[model samples]
Target chain A: MEEVHGRHSSGWFDVCQHRRMSNTRSLPLLAPESDAAAGPCCPPLTERPFTAEEAETAARMFKALGDPVRLRLFSAVASHEGGEACVCDISDVGVSQPTVSHHLKKLKEAGLLTSERRGTWVYYRVEPSVLSAMGKLLTVAPAVL
Target chain B: MEEVHGRHSSGWFDVCQHRRMSNTRSLPLLAPESDAAAGPCCPPLTERPFTAEEAETAARMFKALGDPVRLRLFSAVASHEGGEACVCDISDVGVSQPTVSHHLKKLKEAGLLTSERRGTWVYYRVEPSVLSAMGKLLTVAPAVL
Candidate 1:
């Protein structure tokens, strides 16, 4: 997945490499690198109950996505071509530009997105693993499980 | 899926059949029966930007799950054996029974769980389609898409 973003030169990987140090706010909510490497952050909801700590972490991410405007903004960035979007390109969500920036910051703080400053514009990208991690969190295990 | 619940006899399907009329609160948030039949409620977030309406519906569901206590309770019932759990079996989440009941009601209102009263106890079941619908909402489109 890192190699797939080669077109961005070192910019994308630089963000990924520095994400942990700079984005400490995302540490509690984001799936750890180990979990991303292994699989979803935890087993499906149907497989077992979530511990209090697990519930807290997952709840933070869900809470960030619980707003309609934020959700729309997130979907816009997620669905944008090349799996990234410029704030200028995707900020038309019926709200003021500052509000959109606020929402994007919330999404980034929640670990659902990663952003970078490119020239004069800030570009947002959904971490490739986040969507699947969230999806898997709510997944119902197969009957055999 | 309907037939798979033969053990519950008519009780389960009775809830499903009457769900629309009785649980009108859930209607706005839940994916319609047609969406369930066809596939996920909408294209994955990465596949397309969500309409305001879509964002509203999805946000409602996510908001209901944004609380740690509610999420833990939901997980308890979801992970219970036989895909269902009696109220008495899952009310030990460090909260009062009434509080637990309140959380369960919110979950039901959000269309995450379905409840049926039998004798003195009410049983809750996670509608099989719901987990997958939610999972699909956050799924990333394959690179080919």
Candidate 2:
């Protein structure tokens, strides 16, 4: 789980690649039927049942946000100046420096946030594609709800 | 945590009330300077940092979604016919009956889903407001990314 810039970091990259391929392949398989059926056949929780793989993949991201500290940290970074913040900006979360970094590392591995080293400190920003994908998975249209 | 019809069933209700009250109370507190400042001041996580209470409340929903089995079960219900599914419909998830039920109960208690008894079967449906709130929390505008 402590995969900062390690194999865990590349796991989401693989998921990203798989998702891209799934999108490209599923689009052409849709038949000209009802609008829902006519659209691409990609699997999302709200649109269709989750495959086992999809469940595990999406669960990782949700697990990363499950902790209060991590959720707060993510919010701090997301609403920070220019949508990015360094460790110093988030020091107000009241956790230790190493704890904050540890949580940040989890967010990165789960593909919710990305970090970049800048001289003496590392800055973090929300990963919009991952967030958007998760949001869309859980989002049912208001009318349908 | 087994609060299907217990007092714990009302926990998320309290959280929801706190969130609504927070939203109403925070807006007027914002200084009339910048547009962001003038808008709602509640900690939706995207617009502003989360207070400790908001983090605790929102984290409960995400924690309920952290497990892979629970995540899949939720998807099964969300994607099922009429946006509702019974235990029988989700039995294909490769988990034992009790395990699936346990996860389903957690989802229900977290306010992500609602359950109703129909004869011998219990049906579950996603709670759109809670899902929408969580989705909006993580959803950043495309331009921001």
Candidate 3:
């Protein structure tokens, strides 16, 4: 993504929201406890089993990212120029245009990306909030004491 | 994973490391030329289209967590008491014994978990290093704007 003014140029407003770097230590609120039980709310994964509900939610997200094709397509869009890139650029990658388009659609459905049409071309970029949420789910409070 | 120090337990360490929850940031080391010469020496999904070698390495990892059975299994183990749980306990979670065993084996191969036998039963827990590394790949930087 293009770096202008020391930040991504796509839409700087997202800059004011959740962010991280190798700062794996920080995470937002916990995932809601499994809906199957009225048990106490979330405890870190280290603390106890993630409830069934939490597992299902997390599983869905991971499933979306589980594909090799989709993961790379996500990277290409998230790191492309101007903080976004059009379908024309993404199609230049080795994957077939149809495959690339399919992957992009998945990324969009998963809320990891958003797009806009610039004339005949469609541009895509990371949905920072969604990205941050995924990052948060991966957050397993730092190594235990 | 053995409990360490008495109070906090080594299981916590296992959960973080084995689960691959550690985060890493991809600080663009080499510019992507805006052309075809993408570098290979970067984090999992940056700089270039994933090579066969790279895709295999990455696919292997994603494939490890690709299954619903394994995802639930990993969470089950990561949150198990004493920081680990026996495969038998895992097998009892509504699925057949063989399916649980298979998922556990895949998780072990992917480095997301580790197993050890306690008498006749084998217990598995998250691998702290792997978890941490996985966590890093999803890390995002604070916008510099």
Candidate 4:
């Protein structure tokens, strides 16, 4: 039951959530251009209700971080010595290599993490812009205007 | 297929994700005690890697917001007048009342929103402490400490 549940949850995370935000070009953010280019960006959600497109895009990233394993993997990478980690370095997450890779792919696709091949392993780093944006979007902050 | 995808995703959101954070007392945050009591709380995720328990609790709330429709509903209710709204007011989400209620229950159960019954309908309001804690938890802000 746990295995089936894991498979289905990860599948949904990949298909429904990840696919929805596949086109970073179309993601609805406060500063789409800068955000896409990895610049500082994040419009406050308190300003107004999110449009249909924005909600879908933001929800995908949140969904990507929705699993405990993925959250731990992400945190392990984000909090690594240099703000990134190679597959070998994050091996302590207790999951198999394939599962780790799968979560990495989902995180990258959701824009929360970016990965690049380095030697024989893939290194992953948190996409600060996207992570910041997601946090800011969900923030129901005090009215400071 | 879309329906199946939606059902599966929402089901996973409800099952594994929701159930993990069902206990508010165990939620990870700067001030778990205060936050659980509806007081000010939430440290910062960037401060440290969340413990296994913290990761599980936090992921549940994030997963609840993974759906577009739920996001829309949450945003509408959050942005509604007085920082609260009834089922009738959030009708703009386009789903039926039951769907909205279900999502609201998920949000409420995750500690993001609180509710009270008044007259013919239930009124929902953002739990500032919980919402703030979630935002602070996810925020990878500049190290001010």
Candidate of highest DockQ: 1
- In candidate 2 chain B, what residue range of length 10 has the lowest lDDT sum? B21-30
Candidate 1, true inter-chain contacts retained: 0.79
The digit string of per-residue lDDT tens for model 3 on A1-145 reads: 6554442246532432222121233223233333222122234445455656666555555666677777767666665544466665556446788988988887776556767774455667666555555555556665432
Ranking by lDDT: 1, 2, 4, 3
- Please list all clashing residue pairs in model 2, or write none if there are none: none
**Candidate 1 residue pairs in clash (backbone atoms < 3 Å):** none
Per-residue alpha-carbon lDDT of model 2 for A67-118, expressed as tens digits? 9899899888777646677676676677788898899888887766768775
Two-way lDDT contest, 1 vs 4, winner: 1
- Sliding window of 10 residues with minimal summed lDDT for model 3 chain A: A16-25
Docking class of 3: incorrect
- Measured by lDDT, the strongest candidate is 1
- Supply candidate 2's per-residue lDDT for B53: 69
Q: Residue-wise lDDT of candidate 2 within B12-61, one digit each (tens)?
A: 44443333222111111113333221122234566778887678787888
Candidates sorted by DockQ, best first: 1, 2, 4, 3
Candidate 1 lDDT over B1-145, as tens digits, reads 4564323344544444333233212222334564322225566777788899888888888898899898888888777655667776666577876888999999888877889886655878776676777888877666622
lDDT of 4 by residue, A20-138 (tens): 22222221223334335244333555556778877777778778888988887887766664566666655546677788888888887777777877555566767766766767786
Question: How closely does chain A match the true chain A in each prediction, as TM-score?
Answer: 0.71, 0.66, 0.62, 0.67
Full-model lDDT, candidate 4: 0.64
- Return the lDDT, model 3, position B93: 47
What TM-score would candidate 2 get against the native?
0.68
